[model samples]
Target: MTDSAHIASGHATRPIGGGGGKIFGFPLRGFGLVSSLLLSFASALFTFCVTTMVAIFALLIYRANGHAAVDMAISYRDFGFPASLVVLAIALPLFLTLWIRAKIMG
Candidate 1:
């Protein structure tokens, strides 16, 4: 069928072939890898910092409650790094899914 017939019938076929992919009017093909990495890493870093701070604070409170010297290393070893890894895992897939869906459905 002709393109005009599809349009007249109130049905329009979308172009799926990737050609200069863009989403929300912003160029994405060229930046998809960089953007995805940046977004995921940023999320992980933020989670690490915040969790580390909270861990340290909790350790300080523990020390104040008469605990034998709390090890600051536990903040990174036991809490922050693991939380960051989990965040990175979650954020990377979430970002990639949204990115791919946008590119395909756009």
Candidate 2:
């Protein structure tokens, strides 16, 4: 076989960018594989932060109005209820989204 012919065939067999190939001119494999997980984590963290901020504001307003009991109510069992609410607020939707994503990918 001619050297040119052998070289052409080798080029054809080589993966685009050496296993870093693009799909329809868009690179979405390795990065996309972890993007969903990363997004979910960020979303959950944001939810928790926002919820805590809201709860703190609520307590402050109540405290200013001379009803300190506002803090203790939400702090039931040392903030367990409010914390769990925030977690569920983030987790439920995240779980459903990831589940749907897996099904769609498969």
Candidate 3:
């Protein structure tokens, strides 16, 4: 039925999203602020994992080279946590800027 007929019958047609949605729009139905956090956090987590793995590998190498004392905490304390924080800081701002740019341009 036509839109007017549907409206008169107390029913209204709505527009379906083109696909997913735009990156930015008036209704704020895109990868807005919350999504930027999620994406930045994910990137930070990835950085943490990679740095932790490298730190652990280095510790292993040190142990193999006749170092009797190796503290596993070094991997987390010296590398992973800081790296993740730095990545999170960088990524959050970067993603926010991109999101804002998309929003403004759109």
Candidate 4:
């Protein structure tokens, strides 16, 4: 066979197309590429800061209340599944919204 490695690397002995033209039909525009990269970076930064703040607040609340929080949940008589599910549902949507917004903006 003719040099499998070269074919795999897309740089065979021959130059293939003349003048080293565009690859994959995209013109390799620079401005749009740079703008998208910057947007993605900013979105990631914002998401990370917001999520960190939320986690810190939750930890503070847990530490402050400790047994009180647990006692309150038990008094509600819905400790096991309902409370866990409610927290999961609320937190999941919040996280998902942040992620989706970041992706779209980026």
Candidate 5:
């Protein structure tokens, strides 16, 4: 068949290479690594902030429902640390994964 017909029928497709091309003299692989790290860091920060805010609101709710101020502090002390850690643990990795995928695919 004709060359155009062969290519159109998927008879001339090439395999993908592992080493990606560079951009502006910077390697795409390195860019992906750096971007993933930055994204993970930002995600961790955002998750921590949201977790802290939620914990504070929960404590406030408890206080408004007749608990003492000290009770709020105690509740925060009991649960806030682990909650923040858990959020960071989950969100940071997920953000990093998505960033890496986007960078590599694009």
Candidate 6:
């Protein structure tokens, strides 16, 4: 069959995807199964990491200063870890809930 014949058949094919799935509005297309599974978590994890870095930088500058900053920087390095995770945990559900509501509304 020529290209024109294939096109005329009206059976335009979809590129192979990562099998069957849709998390939120994102289709699990062109990704591996593991990547598809992790896609949902990726946003939350990115949010958490960025928040942690910002918090650490802010705390270091505003709260910790000079000699105190050095000491606190080392001792309280993990301080932002729990705080950011908690924030992410709380925010993620809220995000998903709002996302679902918006999807439904549309």
RMSD of each: 7.1, 8.8, 6.9, 15.4, 8.8, 7.8
Segments in model 6 whose C-alpha atoms lie over 4 Å from true places: 1-3, 9-11, 14-36, 64-106
Over 20-90, each residue of candidate 3 has an lDDT whose tens digit, in order, gives: 35445523234578888888999999999999999999999999999898889999999999999999999
Candidate 2 shows a clash count of: 0
The TM-score obtained by model 4 is: 0.34
Better model by lDDT, 2 or 6? 2
Tell me which residue pairs clash in candidate 4.
Answer: none
User: Once model 5 is optimally superposed onto the true structure by TM-score, how far is the C-alpha of residue 92 displaced, in angstroms?
Assistant: 5.9
Which regions of candidate 1 deviate over 4 angstroms? 1-31
lDDT for each residue of candidate 4 in 1-106, tens digit (9 for 90 to 100): 4677878878677444323245476322222434544444545555545555555566567769853443433323343334434545554554455445545654
What is candidate 1's TM-score against the reference? 0.68
Per-residue lDDT for 2-104 in model 5, tens only? 7788899989843343355555754434345567667556655666566667877887887789976745554445665566567667866765665576666
Clashing pairs in 1: none
Per-residue lDDT for 1-106 in model 6, tens only?
6666777897555444334355676553344334433544665566656766776676678655653444445323565556556655775564555455445543
Error of 1 at 61 (Å): 0.8
Q: Return the TM-score for candidate 3, rounded to 2 decimals.
A: 0.68
Any runs in candidate 4 off by more than 4 Å, and if so which?
Answer: 1-31, 67-106
- Candidate 3 stretches with Cα past 4 Å from truth are 1-30
Candidate 5: residue pairs that collide:
none
Error of 6 at 81 (Å): 7.7
Model 4 accuracy (lDDT, Cα): 0.48
Lowest-scoring 10 consecutive residues by lDDT in candidate 3? 20-29
Would you list the rank order by lDDT, best first? 1, 3, 5, 2, 6, 4
